[model samples]
Every structure is written in C-alpha cells, then in structure tokens.
Target: MPKLWNETIDAHREQVREAIVNVTSTLVFEQGLRAVTMSQIAEHAGIGRATLYKYFPDVETILRTWHARQIDSHISELTQVRAGAGSPGERLDAVLASYAHIAHQTGSHDRELVKFLHPDERIVNAQNQLREIVRQLIEEGATAGELRDDVDPAELANYCLHALSGAAELTTAEAIARLVALTAAGLRPPQS
Candidate 1:
C-alpha cells in the first residue's frame, strides 16, 4: 500500500514534468528544434535515456505534447472569448487580443512554436482547427452584419490566421492593433 501511494505520487511529480518541458522549450528556443535530441533531452532533464523513455517515447512525442498543450490553451481562450457578450466584430477583436497575449508571453513561446512546427500530419490538423476557429468567428460576425458578405468566411479566417501568426513578430500591443485592424477590415459590413 505504501509503495502504491508512492508510485502514484511519483507519477504526478509536477516538478519533474516541468523541468523536462522547460529544458526542452529552452533548447528549442535557443538552438532550434533540430539541434535537440532525445539524448540531450535526457541529459538536460537529469534522467537516463531509458528513464526519459518511460515518460515520453520519442522526440516527436514531446513536441506533440507541447504543441497540444498550446492548442488546448488556445481553445480555452477561444471559449472565453466566445462566451463574452459583444458584437461579432468586437468579440473577434477581443479574442485576437487574447491570442496576442498568448503569442507574446514566455519569450515569444508562440514564435518558438512556429519555428519548431514539424511538417507532420498532426501539425497540419492543428493549423486547420485554428483556421476553423477563425472562420467560425468570421461567419458569426457576417451573420450579424458586422462583417462583409463578399468574402468566404473560411477563406477570410484562414487569411486572418496567417496574418495574425505573421504578427507574432510584433510587440503584443502592435500585434493587438494589427489584429484589430485586420479583423475589422475583414468583418466590416458592406457599404449601405
């Protein structure tokens, strides 16, 4: 019984997990993704290669895990942005504000995420989901007559997503402004 309790606690040791994640994030940020290896991660994580394997099977696993966490966070933020009451345009601006914050936080973690993105199928799916989220918001905005009807919402969303991602290079304030302007331009109702 004591061993079982200990085992479970050890499994959930947040410090260890964070140490691994931080080490890897830092490595990728500084050296780019290709520079890091499982052996290096194991070394930086202060664990043996075999031990690290017990936690994550491969480098791709760790990368996917980190990317998934960011995606999950983006989803949560979107949920809040959607829940808040505002005009469709206003809500999109609000959501983009939140996204800018996320993108700029942690030494531009989002930028690092962009840099490390692998050409994997899963990464493509993640990008699609983000685009879809943007598209849906545009659609809702258009339905509210807060957006133009001429452009396809899906295409607009995809374009805005790329635009916002490109703005990740800017300061948070700059990114927010850019996002606001871009979204407003995309969503502004047709001239009467």
Candidate 2:
C-alpha cells in the first residue's frame, strides 16, 4: 500500500477504536459496569461483534483502556498546570487546586466503577507521577523558604496526597478548595 493509504488506514482504525471506547464508557457509566456487555458495546458503537473483538477481547479490556486514556489525559493536564509560569508556591497551589477539583468530580462516579478501576497498574503509575510532581514542587518551595524544611520532601508529598484525597468526598467546590488550602497550609514553615 502507498504511504498515504497506510496512514489513512491507521487513522480510521484509531477512530473506530475510539468510538468503541466511548460507547463502552457511556454504557458502563449509565448502566453500571456489571450490566454492560461486549455485544451491547458493539451494537452501540455501530460495529459488528467480530470487528469489536478485533479491537478488544472483552469488556474488561475496553474499560481498562478507557481508564488508561482518562489517566493519561489527567496527567497531561496536571503537567501543563505545573508548567504554567508562577512562583513555586503559586504553582503548587494551582496544581493542588486543579487536582482537588478533578478528585471532586471523579468522586461522583459509580463506586463500583471506581473500585474496579483502582487496581490497574496504569493507575498506580499515574499516582506515582502525581506524587513525583508534588514532591518536586515541595522541594522547590522548601528551597525558596516557602514550604517547611523540617521534613523530607518525600514525606511531605505523602502527607499532601493523603490529606488531599479527602477532596474526593467533598460535595462542593468551596469544600475542595478549603481542603486544598488546609493541605497547603500544613506545608508552611512554623512561625518564630
């Protein structure tokens, strides 16, 4: 096949795969994970069962792929937020606020779906990346005399992550912001 023809074929395959993923995600979200089926996804995606199987072997694979895509998008968003021009403390605040907002939104998802998605290695890797981002910011803040120097950055990063995890339970944006503020405050150096 010609180069353009090959590229077109690849693009079309990607589009079909994305459509399948979107349909599967919507069905799982609206009908519950246990209620969704591979045939349902194929019909909803407007693809035949055989075609769908060519893209994914089962419902679990599709859901895992969808979750991985979501995680990648989140990591990219956080990376951009961290890269924004600001002082170390300001950047940290922005990243934490953004992260808390994401947690708040995701908290509304079905409990079973969240539980099902939590055990994947992709989630673990994404979490590690998040921790590293926060740790670097904490180190920068400490060097700038903004955050406390009394604790290791790794320890403080763990504290920040654990404290901010509560944002997932918050019902309001105000509450999430409050949680972020409290977590950020905990990183400040003690007053003389």
Candidate 3:
C-alpha cells in the first residue's frame, strides 16, 4: 500500500487504541484495577464485549500491554536522545529534558496513569529497565569524562529514575527543572 494509505490505517488504529486507553484508564482510576471488568470497558467504549476481548482478553493483559507500550515509547525517545551526539553533561541534560517532557505528556488529569504505574511490581520492572538505561548512559558519559568517575553509575541511575516517578503528580515544568538540578548534581565530575 501507499504511504498515505498506511498512514490512514495507522491513524485509525491510534484512534481506536486511544478510545480503549481512555475508557480503561478512567475505569481503573475511578474503580480500581480489580473492579474494572472487561465488560465494563466494552460498555464504556461502546464496543461489544467480544470486541473488547478481541483487543484484550483480560484486564491484566490490558495493563501489561499499556505498560509495555509506554516503556517502548520512552525507550525509543531515549534512543533519539542518544543520537544527538554531545558531551556527557549535555547528553544527560538532554535526556533528562526529554524524559521530563514525556512525563508531562503522560500525566493525565484523571489520575489513571499514576494508578496504573504507582509503586508496584509492574512499575518496579519499568523503573528497573529505565535505571539500567540510565546507568548505561552514565557509563558512556563517564567513559567520555562527562560525569563523575567515583559515583556508581547504577546507583545514581537508580536514584534519578526512581526520583522521576513523582512526575506523575507534578504539574509544572519547574518540577522537571528541579529533577534536572538533582540529576546534574549527582552526575557532576568530582573535583580532584
């Protein structure tokens, strides 16, 4: 198919997915994950239960799918950050800035996203992956003399990535700036 035709299909898919996501998020936020049944999601979305089942067999599946998608989106975003080609401090700052931007975008007025990712095993896994990536980024920076050599990159990455979970509740760009300051302080090269 032509690129335009593919784009149209993708657009439609995105719309449908958004509908599903919005309805599920609302239900989860209002009623808690266990209370939000697939039938409820179907009714909320104005789709048949069969259609809902076709998209997601169970609520856990929906949560996992959404979580994975969120992770993949951020990973792809971080990949772009990596490509910018800068010093450790510059690259780290850019990455943190991008992360803060994504956090703002992911924040929902209904508080569904926090309910989804809040302080749980699923979130732990997501943060673990993020921490690993941050560690790797720091390692790269350290090798390039962009970050402090003495601090353990893994430890610092865990601190930074874990700290970012608060972005769910934070409403302003100032929150991101605060995080950037914290992250930069942790990453700055120690005086010899």
Score every model by TM-score.
Answer: 0.74, 0.97, 0.69
**Taking the tens digit of each residue's C-alpha lDDT, what string does model 2 give over 1-192?**
899999999999999999999999999889999999999999999989999999999999999999999999999999999999988888999889888888877888889999999999998999999999999999999999999999999999888888888888988888898899999999899889
Instruction: Pull out the clashing pairs in model 2.
Output: none
Best-to-worst lDDT order: 2, 3, 1
What overall lDDT goes with each candidate model?
A: 0.71, 0.92, 0.74
Q: After superposition, how far is residue 177 of candidate 1 from its true place, in Å?
A: 1.1
Off by over 4 Å in 1: 1-10, 13-15, 37-40, 100-116
lDDT score for residue 82 of model 1: 65
Model 3 reaches what TM-score against the true structure? 0.69
lDDT of 3 by residue, 1-192 (tens): 999999998898777767787788678768876688888888988889887776777886676667667777887787678668877667777877777667666675346545655655655665666677678788888888878778789888867765665565677888778876776777878776
lDDT of 1 by residue, 27-91 (tens): 87777777789899989989888878777887767877776776677777776786689877788
RMSD of 1: 3.6
- Model 3 residue 31 distance off true place after TM-score fit, in angstroms: 6.3
lDDT of 3: 0.74
Q: Which 10 successive residues of model 2 have the least lDDT summed?
A: 100-109
Which 10 consecutive residues of model 1 have the lowest summed lDDT?
A: 103-112
Best by lDDT: 2
